[model samples]
Target: MTNVTPRSDIVLDVQDAVKHYALRRRGLRAPRRSVHAVDGVSIRLHSGQTLGIVGESGCGKSTFGRLITGLETPTSGTIRVGAHGVPIAAAHGTGTVQAVFQDPASALDPRMTVRESIAEALGKVAGRERERRVDEALAAVGLTPEFGVRYPHELSGGQQQRVCIARAIVDRPDLILLDEAVSSLDASLQAQILHLLERLQQDTGTAYVFISHDLRAVRQVSHSVAVMYLGQVVEQAPAEAFDRGLLHPYAVALRSTEPRILDEGTEHVERIVLTGEPPSAVSPPAGCRFAPRCPIAEDHCRSVAPDLVEATSGHLVRCHKPGELTLSGVARADAEV
Candidate 1:
């Protein structure tokens, strides 16, 4: 779906967002430590688009999602929703921005029927209008009004997720944060849900922040992708980065893990095995966060930090050398690092 909205009409704008939670102390005079879940992350989303966030667990993609959806307030920075400057960190209600989490079973109340679950999200849309919207949303998610009478337990896994999607869209939100939305489902069901989301976006012009570990799903649904490392976004680029290869070492490492159905003349990229666990976010490395594990890292990489700069049109990468580091298509074992 092509969104021709004015350039000024940015649906979601997050600038230098940070979220840090203090660890519980064991002693009265113990050292104070905080986990930096999301650190200085900035992103802008347009209408009728999808920004897929991919990273390992605890990389702060979910925390970032919570910040934008207003589930949790930021420790610093601003998150604005809509061109009207309506702040999202504190004000995006269920109607303005919604979330479809991984576990559809836990998200829905077994006590409430499908209709009630969808209706609760309707907010102030009262009487006949409320009923109409619920039914319309059910239809949009490939569920009939008859299915609304059933409880969450009565429906299949895919059916329950469909109901959750219905609840999120019933209010017609400007943005939806789907945190591993379809990862819990079977592959076939995941494909169905992804297709449904795409259709819904096309029909309603709703923007989405799809967070998942599944690179295949992210690549399938995202107009653009942002790779988060530790607590910071290391690279951000258009969907073409998946095929054209990424600049940041961490981004390339993540991309290399996924198998590609190569076309004729396409090069086969070997999966780069990353050594060691990610450094603690409480005390991230002084220079590049990925330097300790970077196979191609040099002394300079370990000494200096790189700013997230525009490597090309709409592509931002945080790397001192950028493409100068022989990565992408080349193997680290053979490359002149």
Candidate 2:
């Protein structure tokens, strides 16, 4: 299937997918509650595109990544990768799509050398060809061929993560899911890895679904961005839109709180910190999940859930009142002066 061509358009498509796990309280008579990890999310990744998913922890970002990459089966809904039409569940271990997991060190085999680890994905190729491919993959990620002989334990955290990346890209799969791939790296190293990934996509034409909590990183590397809140996607838009505006309150709050350098000087951003912890997944609030914390919430927002709708060109938002800006109240009052 390596030489087989894929359709030149959409590379990955996920329909309204839902994944829930049962959480039982320690009571003989108490009823079990379900934790809705990923609740009805739909997304599309076009050929050679990078779609970044950003959210607070427990917002189901990683779970959604796992679902799209076929690491776990969804409780309900479908994921289709490439033009092969393979069921996402059936695609795991077969390498139709691959994942570079969060914990880079843990994801690699401590006992196996990097060469062997990458080769494991190739079924059973000749030793020479396998070695060559391993070298090529390592080089593609800025690692030399000699590094392939070293075990995961011998490599630094960044090197180890590159090994994981090499393994994922070695087979030239149609798509890759990067789940917090650079979260553990230092700032400089993270930028290097992100640049390498961008180059890899350009060189190989591989589609990427980048899952990260770093809004700045998402802005730097992604073509499009999707914001998830409490197991649902509250907004999705082109990367540029993140700077202009975000319709969902959760997305707006996240963007406001993200850290950034002030015009490349030493001065760093002072963030707009959000109050309170995220609500429990077992029982997300009725109506808008963010209603409890939303500054502009009205009775209608508290009484009914909002569906994701197109708010602008290529921008999708889930909000009862899309044009109502919470801070605009202050801006309007100031404007009258």
- Candidate 2: give the clashing pairs: none
Specify the poorest-scoring 10-residue window by lDDT in model 1.
328-337
Cα lDDT, all candidates: 0.87, 0.85
Model 2 per-residue lDDT tens digits across residues 223-308: 99999999999999998766666677777778766665567543544344677888999999899998888878899998899999
Per-residue alpha-carbon lDDT of candidate 1 for residues 239-274, written as tens digits (9 for 90 to 100): 975557578878777776666788886665667778
* Candidate whose lDDT is highest: 1
Candidate 1 wrong stretches, greater than 4 Å:
1-7, 259-269, 324-337
lDDT, residue 192, candidate 2? 94
Candidate 2 all-Cα RMSD: 3.5
Q: How does each model score on TM-score?
A: 0.91, 0.91
